[model samples]
Target: MAEVFIGSEEVAAGRVTRHELRRWYAPVYRGVYARKDIELSLRDRAIAAWLASGRKGVVAGVAASGLHGAPWVDPDVPIELVGVRIRPQHGLVPRADRIASDEITRVGGLPVTSRVRTAFDMGRHLERTDALVRLDALMWNQKFNRADVRALGDRYPRAAGLRRLLELLPLVDGGADSPRESRIRLWLLDAGLPQPETQIPVLATSTRPVAWLDMGWRDYKVAVEYDGDHHRKDRKQYVKDIARLRMLEALGWIVIRVIAEDKPSDVIARVEEALIRRGCSVEVDDLHRFARTFAA
Candidate 1:
């Protein structure tokens, strides 16, 4: 009763009187209602959008990614649907795009775009950084074939962001654990640094891995890690991190730790210096050019 529902269906089913519905429910979209006091999650909004579309549209884009258990999705992002043309609303974006039968799947009883289709739509719709961030999260949560996404691109060559999608496809790495990590990775690449490997394992034994480096060049034994507030705020993690840093240093690994307050340029500079110290040649002028243009 508290969940999102079609207003007419609930009233006609005799579950609630019209008066009660008017008193206790709030409109989420035309004809879609949820309890007035309930705060809508992304899933709730997706469901509302679907109900508003009379169950004809498949939820797609970031909302579909979220429903597929991908982390880091902004709950406030508009719910997107394909195959229906419901009027634009605050929380719902309806697309009249055609969807293949195989491209749709059910998530929690609601139709949603399949993982690859969701990835394809995201790459074709979102801006570059945001698309990569969500794609990284989605891929990290659920492994999908990059070829499948590319195939969809081949099918929809005339799609709006196809060029951008092609440009971004090579850059996605599921090993990125957070949006910040993805951002830093992009910045390093944009700055003309060699593409660093991700999730490099520090082996304690042939079969046993002691720890994983967030990202870096293994040949140089240099790594860069982004430390969110949790790394510092959690006392146990803080203590373990200090010990871990010592161990890595002993193993001749230079780890450049990044925190929230560090400027992107400064972090990149530190990484460049570390790489240089480790005998990895980099163009100084190129790094400076990137520093001058680095945004976010």
Candidate 2:
């Protein structure tokens, strides 16, 4: 309930004092500040905590993921929030969403805007790749469900960035930590190919789960994995890689290994070739249209 001061004309009905402002509040960035904390919060966390300090912290990106009940951030990722000053030491990410704070309202009792608004905010601040990663991870890994995010579109009818993020959501591949996977996924989407599944679990009646795949079409028995060259240079790891590939091949699984140079076109062609080889007639045309016609 305590409030950190922004600025005011009267500390005591007279001229402002620089000494007093520094004494009363620790400055954070231009107009922001921590009430009395000595350390400076990161650009992002300071802004988030500042807003969350009763000013309505509009959660987006990883912060929104946490609020939605699934926090999908790298271990090293700081705890980014908007609004408020008080925070734990060394690992918080706060940033200012300097839009009209008045229009923002709490969603799901968390200080975030409605899902649509949150998504909109995310598109603005986060890089497109970062946005896609969180979107894919949240929808697939966290199972937060896209319907919840979509449902808010009506409420935030004019939300700024929703349209773009929605367009790119399906293009986001699951289980991607690196930028290469991100690029591959986007390329597939652009080529109008079915987005490949990320980290799909494979289980058989006769055995326990032997492997979880990076990208695959389980129904078609087609698996596509990006094999960056870094894994094989050492003789020790190279031998192990060959054994794994041979075992997977013996299991009637089609494995396509590829690398960075194939960017854009190769991923699309490879997935298409695999599906066709497996007797699945689905063209790249009908891939992402799965949810378009059906209304849930």
lDDT of 1 by residue, 34-69 (tens): 899878898888988988898888999999999999
**Tens-digit lDDT string for candidate 2 (208-230):** 77677777777777776676677
Q: After superposition, how far is residue 250 of candidate 2 from its true place, in Å?
A: 0.7
- The C-alpha TM-scores of every prediction are 0.93, 0.60
Q: Please report the candidate that would top lDDT against the real structure.
A: 1
Lowest summed lDDT across 10 adjacent residues in model 2 is found at 287-296
> For candidate 1, what is the TM-score?
0.93
Residue-level error in angstroms, candidate 1, position 72: 1.6
RMSD of each: 2.1, 8.5
